[model samples]
Structure formats: C-alpha cells, structure tokens
Target: MNIENYYNIDAQGQIVSFTREQASSFAKGIAGDFNPIHDEDHRRFCVPGDLLFSVFLAHYGVSQRMKFEFSGMVVDSTQLIFPAQLSSHMSLSDANEKNYMDIEVSGDNSKEAEFISMLSEKYVQFSSKTFPHILVPLMEQEKVMINPSRPLVIYKSMEITLDKLSGKQIELSLKEASLTNKGKKGEVRLEFAILSAGEEIGHGAKNLLLSGLREYDASQLDDVIATYTQRKSEFLAVA
Candidate 1:
C-alpha cells in the first residue's frame, strides 16, 4: 500500500498541520496555564502537553483506506515516551536519517526527561480511544452513518435504563440515501430513527455516522453484535 495516502501531507513531509491557536490550546489544556505566552502575539512559551499532542498527531498516519480498517491496526505503544518543547513559529520537517520514531525538542536533557514522563502518562490516558486499535470503524458508524458499517453491531454488553429520560437503549433507523462525488469530496446521506424497546423515541438526519463507526474494535465486533441482537430478540419475544 502507498504510505503517502496514509496521512495529511505537508510541505515538510509531516502527517499533520497545526495552527497557533491549536498549539496554544494544547499547552493550556495540559499545563493548566492560561498564560499569554503561547498566544501568537504572546512572549510566553508552550508547556509539555502542547508538544506531546503535536508530535503525536504529526507522527500518526490517518487516511481513507486506513479509516476502513480503523480498529484493526495497532500503533507502536513504546514510541510515546516523551514530549517535545515549543517556543515560537515551528513546523515539522522530514528526518530521513532517523529510522526510529522519537520526539525531538530544544530543551536541556533534564527538562526533556521530566516532560517526557509527564507527557507519556498524559498520552496514555488521552489515547484511550486510539490505544492498540485505530478506532475508525466505531467513529464512522456512530457519527457518519445511521446503519452499522461492518454488517454487524457489536458491544460488550448493552443495558437499558428505562427510567432515564435520555433513552439509553435506542436503535437508529435510516431513511433516504444520497450520494455526492466531487473530486476529493465524496458524500453519502442517511436518515435515522431512535427506538427503545421497539418504541420510537427520536429521529433525525446524520451526515457523519460513517466516521463514528471507525473506532470499533475488530475482535469484539461479531461477539458484541450477536449478544445484543439475541438479547433484543428475546426482549421482543417476551413482549
């Protein structure tokens, strides 16, 4: 497969692009700093978290084909050891000499080590949705399409809370379908209905259901679906 299509391309051959706002927000989120240093016009600098998220996104590859096998692929969990430093205007450039994945920053070794430890823990917690699996399928189904993308609906276990007003156990039904093709822009449409115990609770139009389905774990797909479907059938039989 072509690796080039696996990521967002940049002139510097990196996988992601970021704006000053994004960088600033990342720094603020991780460091808990509302300082002006990270702003475009501010003299303050970035915190450990900013560098961690940026480098992670920069190195990770995401593409249309990859999205298809979203939860099937696993990332190298060891490479996320540390965070990089950010001061001013900076961007990623291809490092052809290095065969291994490592984060590089412009601080002293002690600072680097300190930040690395903090960032590693942060990423492990933040990457919950992406750990060990790509998670593209679940995202696609939940957000892009009303129907399941894998010809199956999987769950560890689904519990219905009837007393809850939010309607915990609900099924989405699709309505009219549409397609659009314009260069790199491809489109599809699906209408949906929310049902609980065979009773309609809500209905709506969803454009991003396909993207939500991408986050599903491949191994659990079939087992989860079978269990849920069987339970639903039994409930119906009793009713």
Candidate 2:
C-alpha cells in the first residue's frame, strides 16, 4: 500500500488537508481500528491518532528514542501542514497554528526508507490491537468500563527507546499493561518490546486516556466485545 495516499500528503511531502474519508480508510485499512469515532458519519468523528503518527513517521522518519504527545483532535477536512523541516522537537499544527501533537526525537535516527516503513507497519499493527485484545481484559480486571453510550478513549501519548534496530521485519510483544483510575477517568499504560530473530531490540509504551468511565457490568462488557468482533469480522471479510 502507498502509505502516503492514506494521509493525503502532497508531492512536496506536506499534509495540506485531511478528510474523513481518508481517516476512515486509514483506520480500517492500515490500523484495523474500528472505533465508531473514526466513522465518517459519526457526530464526534475524529482522525485516528495512529494515522497521525503514521503520517509523521512517513514525513519525519523514525528515531531510536522518540516521544509523541497529543494535545488536540483533528476533525474532518482539517487543513494541516507538516513541519517544513524536522528538528529534535516539532509540533503538528493547523493553518491557524493550533497545535495538535508535540513530537520529540533523540538518540540515533534512521532515514532508511525500507526500515522506516517496516517499523511503522509493525508498530501500528501492534498498537491498533490494544482495544479488545488488551484494553478489554485490562478494563475487566479493573472492574471499570468506558461509558457505554459515549465510549471515549483518547490516545494520549507514546514513547520508544531502542538499543538498536535492524532487519526487515519486527515483532512486538506486550511486556506490561496497567490501568489506573481516578473517579470517572482512567489512564492505561501499555508497555511493549520489539523483537527480531527472537531477540529484544527495543521497548516502548503507549498511553491512553479513558473518560466517562463507570463500573463494569459483565453482560454489558460482553456485548461490547461481541459487537467489536462482529465489526472486525465484517471488515476482514470485505477486505
């Protein structure tokens, strides 16, 4: 797949505009993210955070140690511009300069096209599976659930530190996952390790914010999972 097409970046490698169609396609096609908020017709539709991360990597390249912090949501047809030049730190903003995400890079960096693409694909596939596979179990264990009506889960931030990176393919495995709740809001930390040839090469953590949370009901949670699974199956079958 031509990753650039998913983000609607131009020939100059700048994201002039993003649309709901593009965001929806990227969420389902690239990340397997079936969240309703990513739906084109959803009232509260927002671009997938993973899509933004993929665009950043496609433009700025990947680094040995990197940090990404999300500040605002990108709505449909929002006009955005990638930094003209990359620095150790950069912020993605709109035409009016409203910041959406802050990115920081340190340590070794790689500009190899193949390596960046491989890493991007591997990491995103891993990150996208956080929902039912990881978050569901975690939420069940914590006895809390995101509000069944709204179900707002925000991608907060992520950080990665690597000893070294090589090879054409990488595999990610969860090292640890924890959820902390304070009243109605909760924070989830998913710690993961990157491996190649069955040897660890790097580690990272993805943080998510869960809002409007309430006490979990076993039947309600089961229903949610069932819905999610059916949606995923339908998507896969269509693909």
Candidate 3:
C-alpha cells in the first residue's frame, strides 16, 4: 500500500493537500468506497475519511489500541499536520488548528512500514464495506432505513485493540453488528475481528450515524443500494 499515492505532503512531512481526483480515486480504488459524497463532482465533495486514517498509519504506524473520532469533514487543498510524537490523545488538524479527527492511542506502537501498510489496506477494505454489505442488512433488521431522497450516513468514529502486532497478511470479518435508534437519528455499531493465518489477533468497532431515518421501505432502500452498487460497477468498468 503506497500511502503517499493518496495524498500530497511537503518535504517536512506535513500533508499539503489532496486534489478532488486524489480523494475520489483513493475512495474508489484504495478503500473501495463509492459514496457519492466522495465523488469529485459531488456538491459536497470531501476527502475520504479512510484516507486520513491511512495517512496517520503511514506516518505514525500502528498501535496496540487506538481510537479516532471525526469532528469535521475535509475539503480539497486543506493542509494537515501530524504530531512528531504520539500521546495518549492527539489531534489531526490543519494549519489553523481546526481539528478534523481526535485520536486516542495507548500501548506500544509499531512503526514497521510493512505491517502498517498491510494493516491499513486490510482495515480500510473492511471499513469501506459498511454501506450496502453491512449497514443495509442491519437497517432492515432494525425496521428502519435512511432517507432515500437525502441519505446521510456519517463516519462517527472507530477503535481497535490488538493482542499482538505482527502479521504479514491481515484479514477482517464482522463478528457482531447492532443499531440503536433515537427518532430520526441512529448509531450503527460494527464489531469485527482481525485475523492472521485464520486466527483472531485483534478486534475493532466502527460506529456510524445515519440521519433522516424513516420507516423501512424495502423498495426505496433497495434503490439506494442498487444505485451505490451501480456506481461501483461503472467506475470499475471504466477504470
């Protein structure tokens, strides 16, 4: 995983900017995310959140336990800086110090490039599948669906804890999923396991929010999923 291919950084190691194409490409090609919000032509185009996670790992490497909370969405050409040292809590922010992600990390950290790269690719692959593959079914089970006309699925936060830190090939599988609804707002929690050589090595949880929820309308929701799938297929066909 060549993380530098996804974002631009200066000689001093400060992330300089991301073009819309870079963001869109990273979302589709690297993370397998086809969210329209990340599309280059979208009205509210923003860099894929997973790209930031990858950059952090690319710079600071992986930790035994880590958590990330997204506070704001990033647009093109925004400058970002990572701390030179890790702390119990850290912020990934811009030149103005406007924070986008709040990070909490503890336990020993590994700066091994190979391990970090593999873990990043594996983790993003799992995170990117939240839409139709995981969240749709969970929504159906909860008897709710996000608004089709103005669907808003937010990347709220994610965390992981590892029992060990060495693996060449990493894999992930969902172990549990649940959703808690509060009127039109809801939180979807996905718990997954990290597997190496077919054995559990770590566990993680990704939490997302869905706004403008409504009664489950199978046909309408299916249309949304279909649209997303179609976009992915079309992109691949052209790529």
Candidate 4:
C-alpha cells in the first residue's frame, strides 16, 4: 500500500512512554500468556514479540498515517528471528517522508533489530489497514537475559497517576508472553527496553508465565516442527 500520503506527518516526531505492566498486558492479549516478569515485581525481564509489536501498534495509532478501529488489519506473515525482551521504559518516534516513513523504537540494545524489523512490517500492514492493532507493547527500554539465566513469565496491571504528562502522553502497556528454552551454549543473548521523551520509568510490574506454555520435548528437525506447531496453535487461540 502506498501509505505515505495517508499519514499525518510528524517531522520533529514525538515520544511515547510505556510501563512494564502495560507491556505485559499487551503481550498477553496477543500471545495469550500473561508473563509476570514483564510487569512490576520482576524488575528484570520482558516478552520479546510483545515489545516489538506494541511499538508497531503505537506508531499506527499515533502516526498521521492511520486511524484506530477494531476491525483494522490482517498480517500477511510475521517471522520473529530474535528475542525481544522488555525493560523499564519504552518509546516510539514517527518521521514522514515522500514515499515511506521512518520509525525508531528505543528499548534495550539487545532486541533493537528484531523489534525494529517486526514492528516495521507491522507498521506497513497496519498503515495499510490490513489488521487491527496487534496486542504488542511499545517500550522505552528492553533487557535480554543470557547465560544460565532463570527464564520466567509475568502478568500485571498499572494505574499511572501522571503527575505531569505533557507534549503527547502515549501510555505504553504490554500483555503478551513468549519464552525461548535454553538454546545452544554459544548463541547470542537477547533483551530490550522502551523510551519515553528520552526518559525511563522505574519499578515496573512483573509475574512468571511458564505455566502458560505447553510442554514439549524434541531435537533436530522434528523438534523444530513440533515447537512451531504448538506455537501456531497457541497464537491462533489468543484474543
């Protein structure tokens, strides 16, 4: 879709703030698992895809490019190549151009690329009005867990008082959850964060979400297939 003309361009751009509770909730809505780590308690974890997709949705809603509606979009395909963990803060910026747009998401450095690509594609799809907003959280910072890290899930909710929110207060919240089993010993670790007006929030909510994923054991190609099958089913059933 040639969406350049349809958006309300923001040359200087604006930043959006997201709480950990908000991010976790968004991830749960999309992935159907409320991982607690992404919330307030677990000050140290995040949902990967949830963080990425949330930023994309924020761009779609806040940008001059599109309008928000229930029955909005249809995603053609989403390939998550890396993990996108959440951090304390998250933010998004929208810049318009002649033929396309440039969107930037500031989270932790770990999942920046993965988050960018996933959100980029989502941005295209949503801008074209192919699907409703994806249940993803747009964050300001992200944290990728590596090594013999104990992986956990979290779920949470928040009520921000907003003592003083000016210059476009974009409240970011996450609700979906996805966790990767320990990979090969030498693989790269992953993490992410959200940015808001060049600032970060403190002490986000969190909870463990392992019970949400079905148990499966596999190796080689067969194991990969089984895992994908289970994940596909899970993704389909989410609200």
lDDT of 2 by residue, 157-201 (tens): 999888875664578899999999887999999999988767788
Model 2, runs deviating above 4 Å? none
Q: Give the C-alpha lDDT of model 3.
A: 0.89
Per-residue lDDT, model 2, residue 203, is 92
**lDDT leaderboard ranking:** 3, 2, 1, 4
lDDT of candidate 1 over 127-188, digit per residue (tens): 22121122234333433222243321111111111122233234444444443333223244
Instruction: Select the stronger candidate by TM-score from 1 and 2.
Output: 2
TM-score of each: 0.21, 0.94, 0.97, 0.26
Q: Candidates' lDDT values, in order?
A: 0.32, 0.84, 0.89, 0.29
The alpha-carbon lDDT assigned to residue 13 of candidate 3 equals: 74
Which residue pairs of candidate 2 clash? none
What is the C-alpha RMSD, rounded to one decimal, of candidate 1? Answer: 20.1
Write model 3 residue lDDT over 36-81, tens digit each, in one string: 9999999999998889888888788789999999999999968888
Clashing pairs in 3: none
How many Å off is the CA of 68 in candidate 1? 24
**Residue 7 CA displacement from its true place in model 4, Å:** 19
Cα error, candidate 1, residue 53 (Å): 4.9
As for lDDT, the candidate ahead, 3 or 4, is 3
